[model samples]
Target: MPDLQLLCLSNPLLDIQAVGNEELLQKYGLKANAAILAEEQHMGLYDDLIQNYHAEVIAGGGSNIARGAQYMLPPNSVFFIGCISNDKYGRLLKKSCEKAGVRTEFRIDENVPTGRCGVVITGHNRSLCTSLAAANEYKVEHLKDPDVWKLVQDTKIYYVEGYHLTVCVPAVLALAEEAVTTDKVFIFNFSAPFIPQVYGSPLAIVLEYADYIIGNETEAMAWAESQSQSTKSIAEIARLLIRLPKKNKKRYRIVIITQGEAPTISAVAKSGGEIEITEHPVRKVPSDLIKDTNGAGDAWAGGFCAGLVQGKTLYECIDMGHWLAQLGIQELGAAYPYPRRTFQPSKD
Candidate 1:
């Protein structure tokens, strides 16, 4: 593959999604619009989804963002790295990436089976229950491979989802340090609230090296609480995140927080202890048009990174994020609509 502009590190999972009711979610003790790792009790949920409901299997997790971005970017510009078992689901994952035009470097784990996520959709909300089997086997040594490290060096942007922290904090920290040293853009996503609440120490270490931090309001608040800023509002937390001590001082940190149906809030760090904050209202989609809300955040991040790759302004990047998010919500899974729509960056 040629030198890639965007590189992503995440826990890849084959997602089995189905339209379920509130009772189903309650039976599994899952809250709507939340992401959680599946425990022993939830092991049967996947089979239940497949047999009891109308299930749709799709590529999910970091792959969702990678595919979304690859759909907008030039061919071979995006590369993804993750661990997976050489099993049927893993084969499906590789094939899906190939179909989407995203190059991948997957570390094979013989001992563990491929990971899977059960997405139970209730109305427009989705509750995720993930089983991180092979994904949890990713090691720093995999990234140390000459071939993989070279891709890291060639990339302009490095993105990692928070869920990877539980599996390999060392890998994430190493990439963060590399981003600072190479003066590359490092984007971090707070994929779920448990990441900051449960994995605070490692998350803090990696966060200082992040040039961009993206998350929803619930995640932002959890992060604030982890940092002992529990009373801060979302905008204040965004500013605080930007002001966190950073390893890369060449560029100021940027924080973006998305609130469902509310304005997206952003804060950019500036010189002399200043912070620039702005809110971009979301484009309204008719309630009846929403098919699923599973990958809205990933879609937004994908669009934002695609904008960055195209050298668009920050505002334009946010606009692209919103545009992709709107389109993604209309689909049944974490997927964008087919026959891609061309997006023009706003001049105003």
Candidate 2:
């Protein structure tokens, strides 16, 4: 399994998701169609509105993906790096990680509260309003420990979330730099559409350091624009990104761009002089079968990373990613029925 060890660096927050019809939206004083960012004053109003609908509190964001991978992969192979406050939510986040068998190396911040996202879902569409809270308090100093550096050094791959690029640029860059120095395969997710807009420069720098890149259609579009291109398809976007020059092209070998329900394009730098492009068809899923769209991208990344860690070919990785994504969409939140691992862990 290529001696896999993953260091996932991102936020660990609670997601309060509300699912129902338009009447529920009206009850919360929210616009019937769009997602509105709610303040503290709106909490009371939201509480009163959600009384009529189904509300679910779950562990969310990159942490959820880390948890998924931990359960799906071999025991003690996954570790999560982020910051959470020493509050009630923080305690829950820790328990969630432990339950999923993910080791937590989170910094507890006293100044800020635990991070959270208030998600409102109407039919298949959903909106998120996040309060970074303690997640934003993470700094480069948190990654300075020698033990943490060794974890990055020994790891085969580093999976980072693009959302962290917006709130904790310095910390994110620090980890990326260490991953580069240690010669680890750096896999990054582009995350939300708004992330590239807010952290463009830092994200560009991080991309330069990345060995593998994964993103959805909207995030791919935003990243392509940042690269000064006008491509709309994920395949085109992946081609453009792979062709972009880097200082050490030999080390940065693969770029896989996923277009939801469409074929994924993979670009690989060869041992010889050629750059190869391979298109793999996605496994079809019913259009009306989706229960929750949240964390689908993250779940895909986790599946792709699992394949990579298992020494699967690029096509096999894409196939595994599609299968995992299908599993993710079938559930109400991320980390649904735990996935079965294809490879077993060794005692050595």
Over the stretch 121-201, how does candidate 2's per-residue lDDT look in tens digits? 776667666667788777767777787766667677788898888667777777677766767677878887777777787
Task: Enumerate clash totals for all models, in the order shown.
Answer: 0, 0
In model 1, what is the error at residue 128, expressed in angstroms? 3.6
Error of 2 at 43 (Å): 3.6
Candidate 2 lowest-lDDT run of ten: 339-348
Clashing pairs in 2: none
- lDDT per residue, candidate 1, 118-232, as tens digits? 9988866889999989988999999989988988898989999999998899899889989999899999999999999999988888989999999999999999888888665
**lDDT of all predictions, in order shown?**
0.88, 0.72
RMSD in Å for model 1:
2.6
TM-scores for all candidates: the values are: 0.91, 0.86
